[model samples]
Target: MYKVPKLNNQGTEGLEYLYIDSNGNIETSKDHSKLINDPDGVLGNTLKPLLKLPTSMPKDFGFITYNDQPPPDDKGVTPSVNSKFGHSKGLVMMDKTTGVWLLHSVPKFPFKRDNNFYPTSGAAKAQTFICVTFKYAEFQKIGQHLLDIAAFPFESHFPADFHDQLKKAAIIKWNNREPGEKIQDLESDAGTQFKSIAKKLYKGKMSACWLESEDLT
Candidate 1:
């Protein structure tokens, strides 16, 4: 996935997605342990993979991926903008110590649970992503922000005793009313401080703010 187009390597700018294992080693190839697969569903042949973690992963590890468009293999369609759902796409993976959140603008991506595949449609257009790593406690605030935005998480795994807000955010749900704006103060592992502003989607009114520099003392 890190390969660059030879012709446009000079000016092309894009984000690369990589999988890091428990030992802090980057996985260059497909790791079966990280794949989500379910051949059977609640009824039969549903192919809905549970959001549980692989046996090889630590029990505390958890992840959640959501998108406005469901995976094609699921036989689902995207909701209209008029609907209450949030037009957002992203994934959040975390453990007890720290975690990362990846926000992107790709449709029908991350492919099916059966494999690691990217959609041609997504590649045909320009896409952007922002990834950040944060301390575990910040995820609760992140979860609250997701809830406010009415995020639709398609797959996730939050262990027992996990934060209530995170578990709630990791599933499909609607907000009772327009949620209020929120501000979060975060500190990354590198000791960088950040302030973020988030609000729900209402009448196409969506806004976000963050500090992109490390010059703050």
Candidate 2:
């Protein structure tokens, strides 16, 4: 005979089963406490060594590495653009107190058609880059109360101007609008006020780093 056990946590309940094999007979039972107590140990010991395996590069060389080599004369291929939109390039600031996810657009390559082209060899294409700076204390607070912060809505806490600029960027990036179409809709003072506020808030207490679209997506 086999018995099943119920897992209870506060008001939540779940059923789990265990198995036993003797001679040619096999029996299933519910005994999940060991699984809960030492799950990592059991899973880790059962899995084969993953770290020992060597990573292989992708066969699509052009996609992986974008050398300085010029694009072929194929009509489908397009040249890279050299325009920058903002000064804070790829800034992402998360507020622990308010649970806000703020991203800043810094100046970098201008929007252009066929921005996805890459070199056939060498380093990967620089898709997008952004830098962010945040106070150490704020970061610490975020770390200490991450769960609480995560529950907050991002748009409500951010500055109105910053939100507006981000919304514009989102529209352009997400809507697949043409460069000309997006340019016509740019605000006269897109990031000026937001930058001033960010500088005041972050000041010397922040660390700046860049994250590409790949990282964010």
Candidate 3:
């Protein structure tokens, strides 16, 4: 079953969904997180209506790139696996100290530094894009959870040895076991300090889809 619920912490709220049974087993379910895996369904239901946006793109937001943050030395030192993840398919906002998951969006270019917005492709109609935000102290757990289910063909399984190795790596990530990275970096892997951008983009007109019905883009 796919569930879309508003998770609240303090007075703020975030969009959270899962594929699970009453016992909280995600894989046993038939859908297996299908709602978010493919199409944009929550737009008319819980998300599009209640979505909020920031007045401006917060300074804390940045793309998690594949480029080595700090370039190598003159002798051309080798880079680690984590240092080359610049496939800028998405953007994020993070603040590790207090842990704020705020506005997150695939904003068009000129808004995000050196990032361009994706345009509608060949189809009968347009499409919608969205993102979610959350906050918590258990940042590592959230990261592992997302990684476990972040792939396609959701029902696929790996061999015993490979699965065991992956689980071990996940545990190491949860336990802050990195050779050349800091705890903050690992923690931010969960996007603990990201914000949403519903209000910033649509303001009070989310349902309108546009400024006026007669005016088409």
Predicted structure with the largest TM-score when compared to the true one: 1
Candidate 2: list runs displaced more than 4 Å.
1-88, 95-132, 135-162, 173-217
Better of 1 and 2 by lDDT: 1
Q: Which 10-residue window in model 2 sums to the lowest lDDT?
A: 59-68
lDDT for 207 in candidate 2 is 75
Residues 1-217 of candidate 1: C-alpha lDDT, one tens digit per residue: 2322223545532222244433466542133322112133111121222233355456887777778775654556553433566667887778888887767677775565543334545543455555577889888888887777666777777888777778888767444424456878877666767765666556665689777877876
TM-score of each: 0.63, 0.18, 0.23
Superposed by TM-score, candidate 2 places the C-alpha of residue 32 at a distance from the truth, in angstroms, of 39
Please, what is the whole-model Cα lDDT of each candidate in the order they appear? 0.60, 0.23, 0.27
The deviation in Å at residue 179 for candidate 2 is 13
Name the candidate that leads on lDDT: 1
lDDT of 2 by residue, 124-181 (tens): 2112222223432233332222221111111112233333333333331332322221
Off by over 4 Å in 1: 1-56, 73-82, 174-179, 203-217
Write candidate 3's Cα lDDT for 159-203 as tens digits.
Answer: 223223223323314333322211232333344453211111112
Question: Candidate 1: global Cα-lDDT?
Answer: 0.60
TM-score of 2: 0.18
Order of models, best lDDT first:
1, 3, 2
lDDT of 3 at 5: 29
Positional deviation of residue 18's Cα in model 3 after best superposition, in angstroms? 24
Better model by lDDT: candidate 1 vs candidate 3: 1
